[model samples]
Target: MPVKIYHDEDTDITIVQSKVVSFIGYGNQGRAQALNLRDSGVNNIVIGNIDDDYAKQAREDGFSPVSIEEAARQGDILMLLIPDEDQQTVWNEKIRGNIKPNSTLVVASGYNVAFNLLTIPDDMDVVMVAPRMIGAGVRDRYVQHIPYPCFVSVEKDPSGTALATCLSIASAIGATRGNGAVGSSCREEAGIDLFAEQALWPEIMAIFREGFNVLREAGFSEEAILFDMYLSKEPAEIFERAADEGFVKQLKYHSRTSQYGQLSTMNRHDGKDIREKFHHILHDNILSGKFAEKWSNTKWAAEELAKEWKEVENAPIVQADERVRDVIKPDRKK
Candidate 1:
């Protein structure tokens, strides 16, 4: 069966427009989403945050920012846009019992919900409207009337209309603009997000570091190699083209020799072992709740992370990269 994709045509935007939506944490994704919702004519909206700089920014943006407790009490829909690390703490301290019973709970990420870090009430509807892009891109695409990508799902639909409400939010946020929002679950969202952070980036970093080492051993200039590898933003341009065009289709922009070299050498690496390793990480750690459980030990996790970061700072590649930055990026911030 084809996965359900929600579009502006599929969603009744009026459903969300009529509801009182309170956005908790007026920063990052929170502010972008709230502004988009308001511009989409969702008039009954509130911004919730601590009395901080973010709240000040909200006020400057024509919103009357209120306390999290007050916002939780008033809204028919509560969107949790705080960082994943802080969600559980904020929920327990401010939102847990304060959130109105039977009101909808919305999250931009699936981390806490997928791992059951926050216990939700049975009477309420819980859903996710996770943007595939960053907050800035979400707002930018919406403003440009280009449909930005998002993963939306309703976890608990006690109200029976939760799916409709979820789609409505997605539409208002400009997620249904270009193509449509992909219907996905909290677990799937969490698994894929974490897999990229844990599985993919680590391997990428390894490849870069090893390549740097080989070039350095061959008497290449550190500054020259650093620029060639990443600092020149060549890979960033390639990735941008990959997103704008099809991944394979974007290869046409490269020199024929470059394309031929890449395509020919690609067959030598089958990636079967890499696929198996990725599957293990997905199922054994993220999907099976092992990583969440391990991370729940905040003190232990922080200690281990500190040690690992110390090693990262001490790594040869990072040290060389730092020296190269000092030469080429003299005005760069420390």
Candidate 2:
């Protein structure tokens, strides 16, 4: 489907400014968004936790903090900025009954609603304003007056103004400043985001590790292997440039030999096979809810994942990375 992009001119900032906005968590998104909203002249704002360190920080930052239930009851817009794993519990225990009737319920991500992890009442407005970047990036770009494009979606709009409200919020957070915001569906955003996380990133990391290991096992020095694999800033700089400019434009910045080698050898990798495998993984794990089920049920999922990741940390490549960094970029330590 073609996406409709909305800019600041397309949004009525007063819509959000007039509403009482309450943030349900003080994590990355919460802090950045709440600050942005306040700075954008939305004065009726509150934090939904009163006991946590983040809550204290919010208070210190000059915002009154309340309990989740109170915030839900009082605010016209309740933005749930908590982790996906904890959203359902918070909704059932503190939000469902207490939230104002016909008010807006906002989510930064559509994971819970897309997967039916939480149910919304028909009387309320359910919407999402998912930023394309991290919370810090959102705030930084907002400060710089640059557009940080976001995905705006309306799941249930009983009041008939959910999309407008979403766009208003996006504008307040500086998402609709330059390039504006992309209109998308909750399911689309959730599926794409989850697929990227569960399939794409893991595949990339696996390829990196396997390539490094192959070179190391073939008698290449760890220092040389690390440099070629990633420890050097050259690949990182190329990727950073590619993100801002198109990959084709980025290619022009590379040496002719580098560009020719990359283009010519690209087909040597089994691109079709890798894509098929990724599709299978996405279908079985993400679309089928297997991954969510495992994550929710596994008692020590984070710890186990950390343990699994220790292999990369303990690898000789990383030790070589330290040595190389010490010589090439010693100031990085500070």
Candidate 3:
């Protein structure tokens, strides 16, 4: 289905400005978005954070940050901007009970909602304004007058105005600046995001690692191969160009020979294994909620993360990376 896409003109900033928007968690996305909204004339915005470095940063940023429960009590619209894993706990303890019965709950990630981890009051509305950009990028683009993309969704609309309010928040936070805000669902948002981490990024990372191994086997210098692989920032430039231009059309920036080599070889390589791997991740893990279930297990998650980190630390690439990085970008344990 062709999804509904809302542009600059579709949003009314006044809708959000009229409501009290309390940001619960003054971290990356939280700080960026709250400042964006305040700058955009949403003066009634509130910052809710615990007594931490983030709260200190919030104070430095000019917000008189309050407790989560206090903010929840004050806000007509409460944005849950903390990390996904922490949301359920925070909601159960500080937000769900203290928040007004009809207050609208907002999130920048669909993880908790998509996995049914949050216990939202039925009397309240639930919406999402997920920016596709990093937190710093969100603020940078907003300040530079550039636009960025975001996903806006209304998961629950008790008052029937959840969507308008959601889009209002999106535009206020500069999400409607670029290609506009994509109207999507929580499931689609979470599924695709998790799939990229579980499937797409893993494949890309493995490709780089294996490519390094292949060149190493071919007797390439560790420093030279590492620089050529990524340290030269060539890949970053390629990706930036891919973002600015169409993925295939970005080939215009490359030599005709390079373009032909890439395009032709892309076709010659059958991606049966990759396709199957991605399908398995999407179907058996992401859509089935198996990944969420596993990750939600705190003990298992912590253990798995520790094991993965140890594996990565012991990987051959890490030593090569440290050696190359020390020479290229000098740093010390001191």
Reference-based TM-score, model 2: 0.91
- Write model 2 residue lDDT over 1-334, tens digit each, in one string: 7679888899999999999998999888999999899899999997998498998889888988889999989989999999887788788889888988889989998888888777688889999999988889988988888777799989998899998998899889888888889988778888899889878887887777778778888998777877777766787898889989987679889889988898888848768987898889878878887776665533556777788788668876566677878877889889
Q: Note the Cα lDDT for every prediction shown.
A: 0.91, 0.85, 0.89
After superposition, the stretches of candidate 2 with alpha carbons farther than 4 Å from their true spots are: 268-270, 297-300, 303-307, 310-334
lDDT of 3: 0.89
> In what order do the candidates fall by lDDT, top score first?
1, 3, 2
Q: Which candidate should be chosen as best, given lDDT against the real structure? A: 1
Which regions of candidate 1 fall more than 4 Å away from where they truly are? 297-306
Per-prediction TM-score, please? 0.93, 0.91, 0.95
Better by TM-score, candidate 3 or 2: 3
Q: Who is ahead in lDDT, 2 or 3? A: 3
